[model samples]
Target: MAQVLEFKLPDLGEGLTEAEIVRWLVAVGDVVAVDQPVVEVETAKAMVEVPCPYGGVVTARYGEEGTELPVGAPLLTVAVGGTGGPGPAPAVEQGAGAAAEPTGTAASAESAVSSEYSGNVLVGYGTAGPAARRRRVRQTAPAATPAPVAAPAPAPAPTRQGPVPVISPLVRKLARDGGLDLRRVRGSGPEGLILRADVELALATARDHREPAPAPVAPAPSVAPAGERVPLRGVRGAVADKLSRSRTEIPDATCWVDADATELMAARAAMNAAGGPKISLLALLARICVHALARFPELNSTVDTAAREIVRLPDVHLGFAAQTPRGLVVPVVKDAGRRTAESLTEEFGRLTEAARQSALTPADLTGGTFTLNNYGVFGVDGSTPIINHPEAAMLGVGRIIPKPWVHRGELAARQVVQLSLTFDHRVCDGGTAGGFLRYVADCVEQPAVLLRTV
Candidate 1:
């Protein structure tokens, strides 16, 4: 009378329809306790750990790593009674609008109930089974008599799950280019699987190993005039889609201003020299944006195009555009308004590093109320960056250049940088946009404005 229970995939938030399995914490034959982490899942917005709803021995794994499973799919099967002993069958409870069928053994009824409740695995919900039983130890034989018995050797350690598999063609090509062995890597994909990063890591690890150099071979003839061709997919594809949607959906207005950031640059240098990682002008600018959003909450808002309304967020979450080999990604710093300058700088470093390594989760990319793109890093003067929808505004920082300016009626060369602000004209007027840019420029020029505002 062993009781079997099926654990289905849980629904992650934000209306996620599917998830890729990043890893499985337990395997068949392993006994797991209720509320123990059983798997890691990657939804469109974040990577989250899922706990077992019921405690028991895992009997079967339903989904393989790297498989993109829709919500409500079965993930694993667990058997609930002690090993080698039959347990009482499970009871089935019928809900409203259902007809009763012929009664059967509790086991059969339990199976039917599990199948019926297969869909709708929401987070924090319990699994479809009876409560877990407490563990018990077997009694040992009496010590009294006989010949001493030799102890058996311990069993070998079980193999860990391998890299998640990559199903996308673009991901596969990238993995191949990195010379990765997919079988050895575990995916952080929808199902317990391998993804592109797993392959990249494998290649990186392989490169670290030293070996005798291979003999030189003649170069093969060119198949076609050799020119680099990068596929517009994954991050690149996402960027294209986001930008296009922002342009088409948001009524954008661009405003430009010149900021004299001499004091701000000095403060940044001092902060970096005082036991902090090197802080860039871009970072200081981001800090100013955070402060500005606090003073003017409306700037930190989004437009619900479908709902035909403007939604103003209560807190500021800043998104910084980071360029990776895959494409442009905007990893966000949540609750930017609550962070100190030093903490913000640290977070910026962490997010940038994670993005470069392709290890950022969905949570790092969403919930941004405003965005900043540093075109200055590329030596550009200034250009309007498209808003990251449904956010209503974005800021672009340009290169600092020595330009002629009048100081006390005398002309002199001074360091100046151009700032571009793009806002949703539907929600923000040109006057509001200009005021916001001016406030930012004033802060950059003085640097003390931030101290006052903070």
Candidate 2:
């Protein structure tokens, strides 16, 4: 008897209802093993590779690359038992084909089929077969008196091996760019073959001793030739869609406030002096925003343009608008509500590094309840920022400037920073938005407010 199995899209993360199919690694009739990568998906934040949970021959593909699929929708089908006919029909038809009957009853079928095979399995899709139910039994027959077995000679000691081999072209290029010796890297790819990830790991390990490369010289500007055109795809296309949707659908309002952050900067400098990573002013500001959002959960929300509903999140996930060479990329930190300031600083460092290298996955880019964009690094004072939709608000931090202020009736120079909050007016009114900004400004002006809340 032949058995068929359907593989549905697994839940990627919180509040993620759907994803775009970026690529498929297998085709019909291709044999696949459990835990082998079968497809790559692009979620709102990053691209992720999903593995097959069953070992079988692929029977059908449910959707094409670039098609958006909802969670729990069948992605592919596989035929087990070697002789099994094509598996269940895909939920979405790509072409004309005879429809297969819906397999056994949902409750009993999954239970009966899943109770069979015993192996390390992926979540949701359990193993199937008689081996899953078999138990080891002890041998009870008396052993015959053994004939004299030949004495085995002592095994030779293994020789010490050098670094693993490099085989990937991408890894080789990365190693060359980083001025690394491929021979010195222990590869992590299949059969010890070096990959781009391994080369990156090697570079990270030797970062302390490696000298930073000089910045690249900019190309000289020239007059446009007769006709020049460039097709927009991939990141460019995604960015244009997101920007247009945010601009048209979300009714945004902006407010600016100034803070004397002399204390916060001093505190950060003191912490760095004690051998900690250099925490930036923007990072401190992010921490404050997260703290304020926790107090006013309404601020950390998204307006559903299609549903005409405001969805408020229980936890805070801070998204940072990182300017990348390709374009603007917003990668979010998951559960900012649960992390400490120090941990947030480390996450910021990791996120920025991943963004710059274009290494962020889709999961890292989605599910943001709030966002922060720092123009301070570029020496900009302040400007109105467009809210990153789904997320009701985005806070912008501007450069710190020395300004005269009255301290106990005496004129004194203080480091002042401009902060702008852009919020979705559809969900938040002026009063709510203003209060949120005022709370954040208070926290920045007096770092002790954070301690009091804790």
Candidate 3:
């Protein structure tokens, strides 16, 4: 007898609850091996492939591309131990909700449920690793058949049964808000799972779409050209929420000072000339920030308002701001206080590349004690930036442009930069904040000042 098993979306970790379907790797009636990637999903953090736990012919899939499913939602069902597919499937040893992941043997998947690589594919649906690619087994598409003119069969009516087959709260909320009965809409997802799209489809068919009818307007002369509008979602939405919370909860103050970075630039040139790995200018600035934080540790701490106490972090998880196609992101470097300038430079390079390619993991994007925003990349001179919430402070660097300065009583062209510090006023006074910013400026003007503490 053919046994079917349902696999729900597993925890992708880092407190993520839902993911949007990006692409499907296998189709219905396709033979999928255990731990093989079936769909690519985009979480708020990153894009990952959700591997199937069951090895058998794919019976059904739940969501379409761009449909978001919550964690523990059924992704698909597999007909295990069925004779209809290409090869023999492993016997169903586990009951429903047990591991549907890869069994070891390809020859007898119906019998084998254990594998050496099982650790990589955690319980329900973990991340897929680089496994040996098995030959793709797929049913031919019906579109290729001749005379494809028949109307599609009518969808079966949804049953009010023991389980609703609905998983996402967002989906349920939509149906409730729209006053649509969940039992009326036919689910298009695998195994009759109701999806947001299914509810939406029902709404459009039965009731008004809630979109207002266009208002009558007389044609008018065109004025100035309009600008573009980008939807705030994904990374952009996360940024907006965090910054808004910071503004609402935090009493932050900004202090800025101009620094002569000519010596800092010269020191960087010297280091690169004799270097094994060229040190980045940002790394040097980061090194200065780390050392300054050591002296004014108050700026490196956050206020726990509930407890009414300041929590001072022991080590610095340094976050540097990098702009990507997705918008601005801050990738944190762990234990930055213990790293050398060379190491910091290498880490910055790796994280920056990952950000540009949109390959940063959730771990790479969080847990920062402080942030270094080199807004100078955008060719700006200064900015009063909102702090990354819960973190005590942020350091913003402006463009290092050449300007006339007095060097040893002589006016000379020198590289100068403006540094701004935004700190939570609840944690520290103006004196402590000014001391931290002044120390950073001193390091830029005299690179040797950093060596005295080192």
Candidate 4:
């Protein structure tokens, strides 16, 4: 006898309750080895390849790809034991299969499968306690209709959309942001799992094949059309939720100061000039931030509203905002206060690359004590950006450009930048916040000032 066992989705940790099926790695009648990845799914945080712990032949899949299922929903059913045919399709004996089929109102077929699973717990979730026997729910006899009805019961309406198979979350996000239907894109990966390259190629091909709107044949009174709708989901949704929380919960204030960055930029150029492994500009700024935080530790702390206490953090887990094709993400550099400029530069490089590839793990995104946002890359002078919630403060750096300023007791064109500090008013008053921003500005004006604490 062959036992048909059902496998449910496991808790993927990090408090995620559900995941969207990204791709199916196995199909019906396929032979699966224990611990082999059966499906790839996308949660709110990252894309994960989920491995099946049961070794068997797949009998049926519960949900289609792109289906959002709860943590405990049935993922697939497998038929194990009993070998008959050479391949997986004929694994079950013909006699067992015939006896199990539900023919009429009389015969019922079933068997219990053992609960023991391979000790492979991917995504940090595993079955607990002793294995238990599982039995199929019995179906009641169909009630007789008033007339001579012979057809089977009608199916209910579908609430969700059909499935689309794709492996990369980045690909899905791209299609979502561009308002493109993922089902229309062709997959190029194994078993037709869509890759990032496939999406990009499809987009390029679409653009190349598209023609102008015929200029309306004749410009008919150009009228304003309705705006396009964009649903906030995935990375963009996460950002929106956090920003809304920060705005609603925290009483935050912003303070800005213009700093002379000539000395700092010159010092950076000099370091690179004589260097083996040159330090990055962001690294130099980060080093200054650590020294500034050391002097004013209040800004490095977070407010424990529940405990009604201000929790001052000891180690600075620095987070830098990196913009990727998916969206803006902040990858943390752990124990940044203890790292040198060279080390910080190396870590920043590694994390930025991971962010670009959308390969950042959950650990890389959390545990950020402070955020350093260099919005200057967008060529902006300054912005009063919202603070990253739970974290008490964020330092925003603007573009450093040549501007006329009073230097050396005379008017001169100096490379200057605007630095803004947004802090939770509950954590610190204007005095502490202003002092921290002033120290940072002083470091920019005189790079030598940092040597005292460096």
Candidate 5:
């Protein structure tokens, strides 16, 4: 007999609780190899494929595309070691709960189960790798005469079971709030799983059966237009929540200054012109930030609100803001204090490309000691952007443009840029913050100032 094994959604790291189904690679009756990606899911952090651990025929899938499932919910079932080619074609049986998922044969699947099972669920630990082209296994129907079409039978009333198959708490809460019995609601999801829609339909039916209420009086019409409503979910939602929390918790202050970045620009140009790999201006700014943080470590620390402590971090994990099609994301460069400008340029390019492609892993996005917002790329002068939460400070760089300046006691057009520092007020006073900003501005004005420390 083919042993059917249920695979629940594995715990994706970094405290993620749920993921939305984006696409399915394997269907019912399709053959899946061990550690092959069976589905693509979008979490708050990134899009990743969930691979199956067993090599067998897929018996059923739990959710449809766009359905959000909790971390420990059953994703699918596979029949291992069945005595048939692939599995039975999809069939809808009365009281089967779901209408489309297929059944499997016992003997052939059993042999397949033993040979192909790897028991590895995550990407890096086992056979799971980066998302690649799915190797589709075509499922063919059994050779049999088809029955004539007839009127569909009415759905049977749901019978009370040992336990309800609802996975999401939101679905349970909806059913509870609506005063609907979950046992009476027939599930349309796989394996007789009670979905939110089922609970909603039951509630709607109950309302329809009740006596109609009297019509309410009309209210005065307003001239205001209902504007577009976009849901803040996934990346956008995460950003909004983090920024809100940062603003609500941290008492922050901003200090800004205009610096003649002519020398910094010249130094970068010289380095790039004579080097094998080009150096980016952002890298130079990051270098300046790192050096400044070294001189004044308070700006590089985060205030532990729970402990009522100011914890200074030893190594700099520099996060630079990058705007993508999804929204704004900050990808952190690890050990930035130890990296050269060329290395920083390379890592920034890698992370920025990953962010643009929506391929950044959770590890690439977290553990930042400080943030660098180069809003200059947006063609703006200056902005006091909100600090990324848990981190004490952010350094904002504005556009470097040619302007009239006194250089070497003569009036000339110099490349001038505005640099702003926003720090948590609890961590340091204005003097420490100003000293850090002054050091950064001095580096921009005279690149030689960085050499003495470097």
Candidate 6:
């Protein structure tokens, strides 16, 4: 007899409370081994492959693709001590398959899987305690009845007055922001689970059916045309939230300078010509930023709001912006101040490739003490960058192009670039910020200035 064991979604680290099912790797009726990846999920931080800890036959799955499930929700169930051999699970069609019939009691399932479980789910998270046995609740559909056309009631009906069956905190926030009561809106998901779609539909229906005000005495105003609507979720939503918080919390100021980068470009060309590994322009810029921070340490610090003190970081964990198919992401290079330009180039290349492939982890994307934004790739001249929250400063690099400039007291065409520095006013005064930017501008104009620091 096989003991049917349930596997709930494990907690992914970095305070992620939920994840959306991106794809299902193992379907129902397939046998799997311990610590094998069974599904791919996308959280706000990154894409993760979740592995099943218990080895057995995958008897059932819970969520469909694109469904957002909260932490601790049932992911799937496996039958341990089954008849199937443990070589490997044969690949099944990648779709949500119907669950297999229950084979054993919950108590039996819990006892059988405890010994075989590996207790590892993600890189930083593990199961500290034994898995709790959950009794599956099956909701039976009520008899069909004719309902209003505008608001068709969902099956199992709405809970008139009880605890709302909501999963995602995002859905709860959505309802709260819209001033809608969850007790009135019906749910369409399993066990009458309240989904974000349900809340959106209920809000739309209410707008369409609201009572019209009394006709104006003179004339009526023309309605504005409806534009396309895009939901703020996933990576986009995370970026929006971070930017909003930065704007609301940080008192930031921007100062910029136009510098002649002709000598810096010439120095890079020389270095790459005689190098074993090709050096990138971004790496040189990062090196300059690192040295500049050493001179003005205040820009490398973060403010402790509760403590009302400046926390200056000893290391320079540098973050550089990279645009990918998913959106804009900043991957950090750990302990960047200790690394040489060659090492920085290699690390930047590795992280950029990972960002492009959507393979970056939360650990790789966080712990950045300072950010370097190169909007020059977009063919822009300058931009006032917003400081990444909690971090004290950011350096924005614009396009380096040929412009007429004084070359040793003579008008000539030179490779020129714009550098902008955005810093938190609360962390340092204008004089400190100005000194840091001036040092960077000097290094950019005269690459030999960095050699002294090196």
By summed lDDT, which 10 consecutive residues of candidate 1 come out lowest? 141-150
TM-score against native, each model: 0.55, 0.53, 0.73, 0.66, 0.77, 0.75
Which sections of candidate 6 miss by over 4 Å?
Answer: 29-31, 80-121, 124-227
Error of 2 at 58 (Å): 23
lDDT of 1 by residue, 1-454 (tens): 4466666665454555566776666665566676666766655553455676666666555456655555544566566655443232233222110112212453354344334324333343222111221222222222112111122213322335544444445456767777654555544433434444445555555665545676899988978878897544334545777889888888898999987766677778888788846776666787899887776667788878689888888988899988876567899998887877767778999888777655566567877889999888889999988999889899999998888877569987777899999998887788888888899999988898877866
RMSD of 1: 15.8
Per-residue lDDT of 186-274 in model 2, one digit per residue for the tens? 54332344445456666765773456786798887887786777534455557777878899988888998988878877888887888
- Sorting all predicted structures by lDDT, with the top scorer first, yields 5, 6, 3, 4, 2, 1
Q: Which parts of model 4 are misplaced by more than 4 Å?
A: 1-5, 24-33, 55-59, 77-231
lDDT of 5 at 321: 97
For residues 1-454, what per-residue lDDT tens digits would candidate 3 score against the true structure? Answer: 7666666676666666678787777876678777787887767665556666677776556667766677666677677774455543333332222224423442244223223213322233323332322344455422111111122225435557666777667778989998887876666444556666677777765554356776899988889678996555667767888889999999999999998999999999999999599999999999999999999999888888899999999999999888887678899999999999999999999989878765677778878999999999899999998899889999999999999988899999999899999999999999999999999999999999998888
Tell me the deviation in Å of residue 38 in model 6. 2.2
* Candidate 6 C-alpha error for residue 201, in Å: 10
Q: Tell me the TM-score of model 5.
A: 0.77
- Candidate 4, residue 395: CA error in Å? 0.3
All candidates: CA RMSD in angstroms? Answer: 15.8, 20.9, 7.3, 14.6, 6.4, 8.5
Candidate 3 lowest-lDDT run of ten: 142-151
Cα displacement (angstroms), candidate 4, residue 272, comes to 2.3
Error of 5 at 373 (Å): 0.9
lDDT of each: 0.66, 0.67, 0.75, 0.71, 0.77, 0.77
- Best model per TM-score: 5
